[model samples]
Target: MTSMIRMFSLAVTAMLFGLCFAAPASAQATRTWISGVGDDVNPCSRTAPCKTWAGAISKTAAGGEIDCLDPGGFGSVTITKSITLDCAEGIGGAAGGILNSGVPGVTINDPNGGTTPTIKVTLRNLTIDGAGVTQGTYGVRFLSGKSLTLQNVSIMNQGTGSVPAVSFEPSAASVGATLHMTDVDIVNVQNQGVYITPVSGVAVSAFLNRVTITQAAIGFKVEAGGTATLIDSNLSNNGRALWTASGAATANLEGVTIAGSLEAAVFATNGTTIRLSNVGLYNNAFGIKTTGTGIVQSFGNNRLGPDAGSIGLPTATVTQK
Candidate 1:
């Protein structure tokens, strides 16, 4: 047989030369994209996209989702897993952005510890610019997430290195970290525009709806094991527009609106606690300011706005049967 037909034609040419030196399978793409003239080596699919968001979050996948095909500045991103950076359908009407100056435009750290299950980040209709002048240290920095959602987001001018335009500081094992802001918008933040400090048996929690914190110097700050809640929010021109610092820190306001505070529009210190309903204390220079054994409770349908210069009276007035 002619040397067994030449050894079956050299074993089909050595199996096509080992399938042409095969080696291509580094999968990871549950949905990845980014544009503004994308090109991070393609494969971010949706027809070759990718150009920062740290190059399409390492090709997405791990609770994937990194959309936005039109509207750029997609830079600055440090999420570790569990993602979702939607541009909320403004694709062509221009939405997604990130013009940080020094650093930190979003950095949710997720190391995926022991039993896992700690990682959940979602940011929609983005726009986080820490205006220039070397401003920008945080426009979202939930260190080691367990939950952080911001809808219709917009964080601006984060005051150079003074930090805080959103910082749910977790760590200390990342205990129960959680924060949810809806229709959020924080502007001219120069520290504490939403800075819940956790880490020490960490038990942080924050929830603000229709939030809008402006010109902050402390427009919603909670420390210790932090806990905050606001509805129909609006803390404007702050210098201290609601702060519950230290220990059992807690703050809850309904139909909130503390305006033009040069200081004290509800501030509780040390062993904190603050609760008000139908809140609205405008032009405040003082209106419910407690210290040490701090406490401030009022359900008396609050609404003081005669350019409030001193309407402090609430250490317990809960008569809302």
Candidate 2:
């Protein structure tokens, strides 16, 4: 017939040039699955789940992990690599893994750069609620991350003003940042319930275990040259529970417990530096206050009850242990 119709038009132009040169099947993925009636164009896997957490963190990969196959409200999320947001079981019915408002509720920026200079973020069993009315300031916001780990988390209310329920400032070409809070629980935070300021030759370090800070106005606030380590922690009804202000700040309270602070349960000022072991002070109005060139280093199995006292300068350093 005309050479079989020109060989059927050259076999349909070589099958449309092999379907336009194929190759399109990588959606990252190292482990990504979010539910609550998922569907972020599906592909988050695990039965095709993905509804939030910024759509399964772009199909997870950089240090992967975005599990939460059930609980829904997976909203707030702005992490940059080195991930892990394990909802630690119990999601939808709410047993950790809520995240409302979206003000912060998790925002760790990791400028890892080449050769992986550092980048690690692991938040497990979250429950960050800021229903104290439009909560959106901070409930976890560590800039330029290099390390942040919070287990069994639970950050509440979140002040609409001063804002803080875990806020670590690290950026100045960031080269230092580390925080590890275990069994964390910061309630009614309207200000400083863990706020470390570092950005002056950067350097921030923290490690609070069994942490718990209530109704904050300040329940752990390490300033500029940050450094902290509070174990078996608990700073109650705060208005000021444990503040190490200004530069050169440093704290190390072990087995800590400072109660009802209408102000000053342990406020070391500008030139701060504190270290108290086996500590415990009740009904604080001033259990260990210091100003200007602050310094307090008591370590004799402390338990300063009777409304506690130990005000300022003379560099109170009682160590009989």
Candidate of highest lDDT: 1
lDDT of 2 by residue, 235-264 (tens): 988888988888788998999888888888
Write down the lDDT that model 1 would get: 0.83
Worst 10 residues of 2 by lDDT: 89-98
TM-score of each: 0.41, 0.41
TM-score of 1: 0.41
lDDT by residue for model 1 (1-321), tens: 999999999999999998788654656787777888988888777788877788888878888888887876777889888888887553333467787888889888888633343889898889998778688878888877688899898898885668788888888777777899999889888888888998773787898898998888888889888888899888878898888888998988999888788988888886889999998887778877897689899988988867865886788988888
Q: Which residue runs of candidate 1 sit more than 4 Å off their true CA positions?
A: 1-23, 29-31, 34-43, 46-67, 71-111, 114-152, 155-172, 175-221, 225-234, 237-240, 245-266, 272-282, 285-288, 293-308, 311-321
Model 2 TM: 0.41
User: How well does candidate 2 score on lDDT at residue 63?
Assistant: 88
Q: Taking the candidates one at a time, how many backbone clashes does each contain?
A: 0, 2
